[model samples]
Target chain A: MDERAALDLVGGLVGRAGDDAAVVDGTVVTTDMLHESTDFPAGTTRYTAGWRAVGASLSDVAAMGAEATAAVAVYGAPAFDAADLEAFLSGARDVCERVDAEYVGGDLDGHDEFTVASTALGETDDPVTRAGATADDVVCVTGGLGRSAAALRAFDAGDVDRANDLFQFTPRVAAGRALAPYATAMMDSSDGLARSLHQLAAASDCTIDVDEAAVPAVDAVADYATDDADAREMTVFFGEDFELVCTLPDDEIATARDACPVELTVVGDVTGDTAAASSDGAVTVGGDALPDRGFTHGD
Target chain B: MDERAALDLVGGLVGRAGDDAAVVDGTVVTTDMLHESTDFPAGTTRYTAGWRAVGASLSDVAAMGAEATAAVAVYGAPAFDAADLEAFLSGARDVCERVDAEYVGGDLDGHDEFTVASTALGETDDPVTRAGATADDVVCVTGGLGRSAAALRAFDAGDVDRANDLFQFTPRVAAGRALAPYATAMMDSSDGLARSLHQLAAASDCTIDVDEAAVPAVDAVADYATDDADAREMTVFFGEDFELVCTLPDDEIATARDACPVELTVVGDVTGDTAAASSDGAVTVGGDALPDRGFTHGD
Candidate 1:
């Protein structure tokens, strides 16, 4: 079974599985598991790995428009190293502090490979969901895309410093909290812009018409890509930017932009027309279908 | 670094460690990581693995004297099998149902080895910690010991059915909730009675005198052991029974016994005398020092 099908099976048993985080009585909780082979690159430092791993779960909380309170990590490796463990904890603590949250310890065990499972806890009385988008709502994204793609390129080129720096993107918790009151629907763009757009449209039963020119591509994309088309492709499909992709009323866009701490780029608008909708939900950019592909586990 | 030393380092960074569960306001949260090589035997089924792994986290919540609300797990393995995934989810759901908690959902990833990370969330107005044991308090335990030891013995002896059955021991959530009002200091004996006794004594700054004859050993211990001495050794030193070990006021022991659903066995008492206390904290059984040995990770 693939990750999605396995997730569906888990959903069948648990009944509450599709949301980014599970909320119970105003408390939001989410968990993310990452393996060294799949998540970290060849030159990735233990500190970078720790930051990226915990940041993934915190991004889930951000998707729910929740106030991140604390996080705990479970680290498993074949053996324990004193300096490496300290570096990992230092990174985890720094990331939590960056988001105004606490890193409140975790469990450790020995395994064959370096693996991390991080859980983040948050709070929100009015949490956002992917299924709340409506026709005529404006879709927007935070910061720039293709940051992780640029990082991977740098790693492949043996520029470890540039790769590590790019790997340390800030999670959009503050922006999510600021936009929560104005967003009609919201989710994090961890799955890349294309896949995230498809998911939001499908969940809301709408079509998203995105202007390819309006998507914000990071400056690094130009340095890494061969052409403008390649840059757009990389920005739109390569994930791990840790940016928020959300929908808001056209009238509330200016207010949300004012309230948000990060740059808000207007990328698209939602529509109720089924003419453009497909099984994977309609996500059209520059009058063409956007492929439903992004960062997925066990691919 | 060993697991304990690593945990202390984490505690130094987080400033809120050493407790079974971290309490924030009225919310209780805990996490556990287990590896196949360290946690599961050759004949252990995926279903039993799921139950035991999630039960470990729930047992932590129970030790905090909290009401378990929900749990999430991150499952990572070398490959995904449909039947195995379904069985694992079924076991997770069944265990949550047994404790009246929700098995909400989890994340999945492919790793080189089968590993599981589980987190349990709970609610409590007053959580019992391991630092409240006072002199003259009676030390009591719930359920029988050596259950996991006997299960391991059965697994080694080719009794897979008996081993699986024994691995499905219930988490002591209800009994902990019942004993919360009376328990001055409480914890789950996941590290065996010896280590747990030593830990509680150190945390509370006291000494514990245990009656070796009063320790309750399960019937399976005798069935698997060669003689009474071996049975007693297994029961006292082999851990993973998921039973509650608590210190209660001498005057409240009778009422606590009446309130708890499980049979309460009074096997020891707390004392203020430093003559018997050592660096690992004093735990004397029949006038002899109890060795601080139990199940530990990466041992």
Candidate 2:
């Protein structure tokens, strides 16, 4: 089974398992495991791998609208190279520091392939979940989409430095906390806009109708994609940008924008279209059906 | 570098890195990553693997004198068999239930080898650290030692049922919380009693003198080992028992005993003699030197 089906099985076993981060007693906790072959591309530095792996969990904390506190990683590889190990730690620490979180120590092990399992923790009295959205809520996202898609293009072109830079997008922790008070529902767009919108719709029991013209496409997409249509497809279907996708009432958008450090772009609106709702939820972009296609681990 | 040296490197990078579980705002969190080749022996079932992997993180929580609230694991394997996956989740959930903690959902991915990364979160107002032992405090252990060593022997003898049963040791969460208020220092002996004593001594800046005869070797050790000395060696040096080793004052032993559910076996005492202190904290057993030997991950 794919990641989504596996998650469904997990949800069946765990009572509180649907949220991006599991919040227990005001503490938000999440974990992400990345394998070298599956996650890191050719020429990707150990440092970049470390940063991206840990940042994935941090994004979950951000999705919960919690104050990022600390993170730990478990690194495994066939052999320990001093420089690579040091670089990995530096990357992990730097990313945590960027988001006002501490990079606590982690475990190390020997494995045939390089692997990283990162866990991030945060705190919040009020956590915004994907299940809280209403029909009238405006759908919005922080930063833009397709940054990771562009990074993949760069990696394909052997632009290692550019790819690494693209992989270093900041997790929207501050923006998440700022929008928590006003956001009806929130989650991270690590699985692409289309998939995330579908998830948000299903969780909130509503449909999300996207205005294609209003979707914020990162400039990097133009530099990497073959054409404008390709860029739009990349922005909607490719994931790993680590951006926050949230919903808010139309009246609260101005206040949320004022409080948020990053730009909040409105891309869609939650709708009361129960007739169109299916297992994948009714998600449309540019008046066209959006498929549930994105990064699926273990696929 | 080995696991200990790697830990030192990690300790140097993160200030609050030496504890078993990092305590932040009264919340304790710890993570453990285990690989199939390194951690699981032949004849091991996926269920046992899940139990032992998650149990390792719970042991860390128990060591910190906290109430475990929840746990999440990230599992990666070459392929996902329906039965294997279900069994793994069941094992993980059962272990959490045993400790009164929730088995929260986890992430899954495809990897070249089977791997599990588990994180456990706990809560506590007062956390017991490994650095609190004093000269006059008595060193004690909960549960017995050499259980895992015996399990390994069982596995070698093709006693899969007995091995799996032996591998399923209960994490001393309740006993740890009970001892927290009175114990001066506390840690789990996953790394075996000899190494644990050395670590406790070094962290507490004291020496530990052990009565070897008093060491509670599991009765199964006799069935596994060739002789009494072999059993004693296994009890002291072989690890993965998941028992708590603590330090308590002589006068408070009775109160601690009453509060604890498990047997509080007094095997040693902290000493003031600093002249003999080495890097391993001058640990001795039965008037002889006890080497810092135990299971070392990534060794």
Candidate 3:
């Protein structure tokens, strides 16, 4: 079994769990672990490592439509450096401040490789899960995509500064909060846009139709990519954008957009034709099939 | 620097963070990561690995006098196996059920080494921290110790079953809740009694004088050990016994003891002689000093 298949097996055993974080007694809890080899490339700063690790988990809280409260981190490194630890912590604190959450505390250990495990907690009376979308819901995404993907290419090309800028992403905490009450379903586009749609659709037992023209590419993505792959396709296949993807009624979109601190774009529509995308296919982009393509861990 | 020194550097960055989990707005959050190589002995089962990973964090919740609500785990393995993953998840779910908490959800990734990162959440209106003990308080520990210490000896001696049995520990959730209101300070003895005492003293700025006869040794511990050391001293220096240690008033000890579901032993007295323990010495045992000598990661 691949990592995804193994995860699916484990998920089946865990009761009442959804993609992203889990909600228990009005609190949303989530965890993410970043290893130096898999999570950080060369030139990735310790500060960025701290920020990215915490931000990844916090994004799950946003996906749940909850107000983030606090976060704790467990750090494991072979050798401890006073300055490196400080930078990493400062990064986490700054990111927590951005979302008005507390970097409360965590544990530290020694390991053969540097590892960071972060857990974030948030509170919400109503949590928006991936299964809540309806056939008539309109699909909308906060901010744009392909920045992280394009940054990876830039990093490969030795443009460390450009890639670093793209690596630093802002979690859509405010945007998720603004859309939660109206959104029929929601999740973060941490995986590629195509995979995210497939997951949400599978969870809701519905089909999502993507309007190829409607997908907005981040401005810097096109200029930064090393290849000439269409920016929209790049956005669809590349992951780690950290944007909020939500499905709501068409009329509610405006209210959500007005409430959000960032730009909102309508990317697709929720459809009743569930079989259209599941028949030996992944996602529907216009009439073409878009296989679930993105980063696969341990591949 | 070693793990402790490195951890000290990181601890300085976090504000008001205690040794165990941190409490925020009545919610207790803690994270722990277990790398297979460092954490698991050769004969450890996947189920035991899962249980130990989640149980360690839950023990932190118990130390804070909180009722655990939920837990999430992030699993990373080089190549996924369905059976292995199931065993791991089953272990986590079973442990959570034991504590009356739900194993909610978490992230999954792939890596070269098997790693389990678990985050536990609990609720407490008043959290018992390590810094709350005053000079007038009495230091006590729940249950007997040195099982894990003895377990380590057994593992080295090829007694896998004995070691695994000892590794699977129950978090003191009920006992912690029972003692929360009365205890002045609290923490888990995951890092050995000596280290825990030193930490509590440093955090609370009070000295603890351990009575030699008061320390209880598990009957199995003596039989399992290969060396000729004092059983109680072995308990003090060896760690990973998931028991609770707290400080309360000398008179309130009985009330706390009456409230506990487990045996609560008065091991020492919290005193005003802070400088005595802090003057490059750790944990006073009779006239001799018990050095913090438990497992040190990356040592």
Q: Candidate 2 lDDT, tens digit per residue, A1-299?
A: 76688778777777878889988878889998998787899878988988898899999999999999999999898777777888899889889998999888778888889999999999999999998888888999998899999999999999999999898779899999999999999999988898888898888888888987788877888899998789877898888779999999999999999999998999998876556564544897655678878877788
lDDT string for model 3 (B122-177, tens) is 99999888887887688899988997777777788898998888888888998899
Please tell me the TM-score of chain B in candidate 2 relative to the true structure's chain B.
0.97
Compare candidates 2 and 3 on lDDT and give the better one: 2
User: After superposing candidate 2, which stretches have Cα over 4 Å from the reference?
Assistant: A276-281, B278-281
Worst 10 residues of 1 chain B by lDDT: B272-281
The 10 consecutive residues of candidate 2 chain B with the worst lDDT sum are B272-281
lDDT by residue for model 2 (B113-225), tens = 88999999899999999998998899999988999999999999999999999888888999999999999999999888998888888788888899998999877898989
Question: By TM-score, how accurate is candidate 1?
Answer: 0.96
- Scoring model 1 with DockQ, what do you get? 0.73
CAPRI quality band, candidate 3? medium
In candidate 3, position A253 carries an lDDT of 82
lDDT string, candidate 1, B1-299, tens digits: 77777777777767777888888878888998887888889898989988998899999999999999999998887778889998888788778878888898888887777888999999999999998998899999999999999999999999999999899889999999999999999999998998898888878888998998899988899889988888977899888789999999999999999999999999999976456565544888766788888877766
Model 1, A1-299: lDDT tens digits are 88777877787777778888888879899998887787898998889988988898999999999999999898887777888898898888889989998888788887778888999999999999998888899999999999999999999999999999889888899999999999988999988999898888877878998988899987888889988878877798878778999999999999999999999999998866555575544888755788889877877
Candidate 3 Cα outliers beyond 4 Å, as residue runs: A226-230, A275-282, B227-233, B275-282
